[model samples]
Target: MSDYLVRALAFEGSVRAFAVRTTDTVGEAQRRHGTWPTASAALGRSMTAAVMIGAMLKGEDKLTVKVEGNGPIGPMIIDSNAKGEVRGYVTNPQTHFDLNELGKLDVRRAVGTEGALTIVKDLGLRDFFTGQVPIVSGEIAEDFTYYFAASEQVPSSVGLGVLVNPDNTILAAGGFIIQLMPGTDDETITIIEEHLSKMEPVSKMIERGLTPEELLFEILGKENVQLLDTMPVGFECNCSKDRFGSAIISLGESEIRDMIAEDGGAEAHCHFCMEKYNYSVEELESFIDEINS
Candidate 1:
């Protein structure tokens, strides 16, 4: 099934929740980046959480999530907007290791226990917000939970999971974010915590083919959750040949001339989607003209 997200409220709007089924979305990233099992888990987990966070914004607002850990997989970058579009990549896609003590993907080993998770939000009109927190857990979900409490100052519970196939493909990937708005009573918090403690892993629930709404129902109780709206989610990259060409043109006429004289052409590669754009020598000359004009 195609990926999608659902928003909901519980306990008369004192608690807000978001859940998403991202199997296909994460599969696309695995295929495009050739990420190994461990690396796939790390990248998929981050993207899963970031997409849900994206749903919290409005209009043209967007955010970028950076996971910089001191492990073999290096850094991970995810970009998402309020519209449910997300794209991401890890520094080392081929990184992997044996399962951990819990028999799950060794994400903590691939993403070291030390470093930081940073969020940069671009609100329209040049308004931006930045939040950074030390990595409390190499597991992407726990790190985000800490980020909410320490950085954003919201009490939140985050559950993220990615199950990888033996051939390094994604089996399932999804997550949920539950938060308490200001003025939430203590009784509501205790009830939510009790439900979370008895829930299944988010990845397993997703693999069982639960829809986003069902995922929320399972976590927040069907009787308590008030379904809000659903939005489609996918792996989308906005890079194009024209966009890359514009970037090259901005390098000035002299730089364009040097490219034609030395290399005969230019090639631009996108890290997010692994797409390459090639410009012929003639194309290079036109860019120089465009720059001069």
Candidate 2:
């Protein structure tokens, strides 16, 4: 099934929740980057959480999430917009190791415990919003939970997981974020917390074919959840050959001429999707003339 996300409020608006199914989205990233099992799980988890955060924005708002851990997998960078588009990459795509004691992907090893998770939000205003929190757990979901509580001062529970196939493809990937709104009564918070404490992993639910709405129901209790809206999500990049061409021109006539003389053309590769764009000799000549004129 195509990937999608849902936003909802439960417990008479005292709780906010977001859930997403990101199998296809993660698969696309894995295919493009050729990530190994552990690296795929770590990067996929970050991308899953990024898209849910993107849902929190309005038109034209965007955000970037960075996981800079001191592990072999290296730093991970993800960018997302309010329109549910997201793109991400890890510094090292081929990192992997044996499964942990829990018989799950060794994401913690691939994304070491020694760094920080930082978020930069551009709301199209004079100043951007920035939040940073130390990595509490290399298992991204718990780290995100800590980030909201510590950085944003919002009490939240985040559960993100990605199951990778033996061949380095994505099997199932998804997550959920449940937060207690301000002024939420103690009793309501305790009940929601109880359910989350005993709930199965979000990836397991996705593997079982549970929808985003159903996942929220499990977290908030069906009687208390009130579905608000759902949006389709995917791995999307806005880079194009024309955009790269303009960038080449921005380098000035000297740079364009150098490319034509030394390499016979210019080649650009997007970090997000690993898509390559090549400018032929003719194209380079035209750009050089445009810049000179």
Candidate 3:
């Protein structure tokens, strides 16, 4: 099935929740970046959480998530919009290590134990909303859970997981975010906590082929979850030759002339999707002419 996200209200609207399946989306990322097992897990987990966060926004709104830990993987950057389009990359795509004590992909070791999780939101306004917090846990889920509570002052539980195949491709990738509104009663909170404590890992659930709705029902119970909406999700990059050309044009005529003279061509590389755009000498001259015109 195609990747999609489901938004739901539970406990009579006192709690908000989101769940998404990102297996195909993350597989695309692995193929694009050639991430190793550990790096795939780290990047996939971040993208899963970021996409859910993006669902909280409205039209034209978007957010960028940065995981700058002091690990071998360097850092990860993920961008997502309300439209369910997400793209991301890691500074070191080939980083990997042996499994941790739990026999899991050593994400904490790959992501380091120090640094910050930063999120910048574009609300289509004059000022952007930026929230940052220290990495309480190198594991992406716990870090985001802490981010929501400490940075946004919203009590939340974030469950994210990514399983990598033996061939360094994505096996399953998905997550869920549950938030408690101000008036959520203690009983409801206790019940949700109990459910979470007993539920399977998010990655395992996805590997078991659970749909987003079934995933929520597994966590929140069928009677308690009220599905609000669903939207398709995938790895989508906004980069293009024209977009890169516009950037080169903005560099002004002098820079364009230098590119034509020194290299006879220019290339722009997108970090998110690893796609490169080449500008030949003639293309550079046209940009110069466009700038002059």
**Per-candidate TM-score against the hidden true structure:** 0.98, 0.98, 0.98
Candidate 1: stretches off by over 4 Å: none
- Report residue 203 deviation for candidate 2 (angstroms): 0.6
lDDT per residue (tens digit) for residues 148-224 in model 2? 99999999989998988778889999999998889999999889889988999889999999999999999989999
Over all chains combined, what TM-score does candidate 3 have? Answer: 0.98
lDDT of 3: 0.95
lDDT of 1: 0.94
Q: Kindly list the per-residue Cα lDDT of model 3 for residues 82-126, writing each as its tens digit.
A: 999999999999999999999999999999989999999999999
Q: After superposition, how far is residue 90 of candidate 3 from its true place, in Å?
A: 0.3
The candidate, 2 or 3, that scores higher on lDDT is 3
Better of 1 and 3 by lDDT: 3
TM-score between candidate 2 and the true structure: 0.98
lDDT score of residue 24 within candidate 2: 97
Flag regions of model 2 displaced more than 4 Å: none
